[model samples]
Target: MLYRAPHKTAVDPDTGELFTDLLVIVVPDDSAKSALVEDPSVPFFTVPHFDGYNAVLVQESRLGEISRDELEEILIDAWAARAPKELVAEFFADQ
Candidate 1:
């Protein structure tokens, strides 16, 4: 997969440096088309699309070093953080 710098700027409070080399994978409709980062040592995150089938994967270049469980946790958190609150409310409104 191709690696491009994230256009959005969000400072890492702990590092205090401009994050430059993170990866973002945007899947269209079907998750099958998604791209995977080969490395297993970097931090990773993901955002599931509102429709549920698509998602965006964000991660550091060295995700290979991180444990699978940790990566999954980060991805789930990112997915929750990225989801639109209003949309989520609508989905849960009937419950």
Candidate 2:
């Protein structure tokens, strides 16, 4: 399942300011969950549930503040690491 936090923040740079949205993705399976939690690149927080799933957080900032391409690449990398192949394919196929 996918979850999102209500918090939003902005990154400011010489060009302008960029707003970011936070998100959390919960995947089923212990190994995948562990892999995601261990990855240092993505910012994540563990949920309090006893289930094997984990929560991965990501932020979206403006192009001027931080390249949108880079932000999306980070999100995709984390999502692929945590989510099952089928789930990832399905999510992206629709988009």
Q: Which candidate leads the pack in TM-score?
A: 2
Q: Which stretches of candidate 1 lie over 4 Å from their true place?
A: 6-8, 28-42, 46-57, 66-95
User: Candidate 1 local accuracy as lDDT?
Assistant: 0.48
Write the residue-wise lDDT of candidate 2 on 1-95 in tens digits: 34344432323234344323545554445665676557665444353442444444434331234356855664576667767899999988998
- Each prediction's RMSD to truth: 12.5, 8.7
**Residue 27 in model 2: lDDT:** 47
Model 1 vs truth, CA RMSD: 12.5
lDDT by residue for model 1 (35-94), tens: 332333444344322235344455465667667886565454445445788865665575
Q: Which residue segments of model 2 deviate by more than 4 Å?
A: 1-3, 7-20, 49-51, 60-95
lDDT of each: 0.48, 0.51
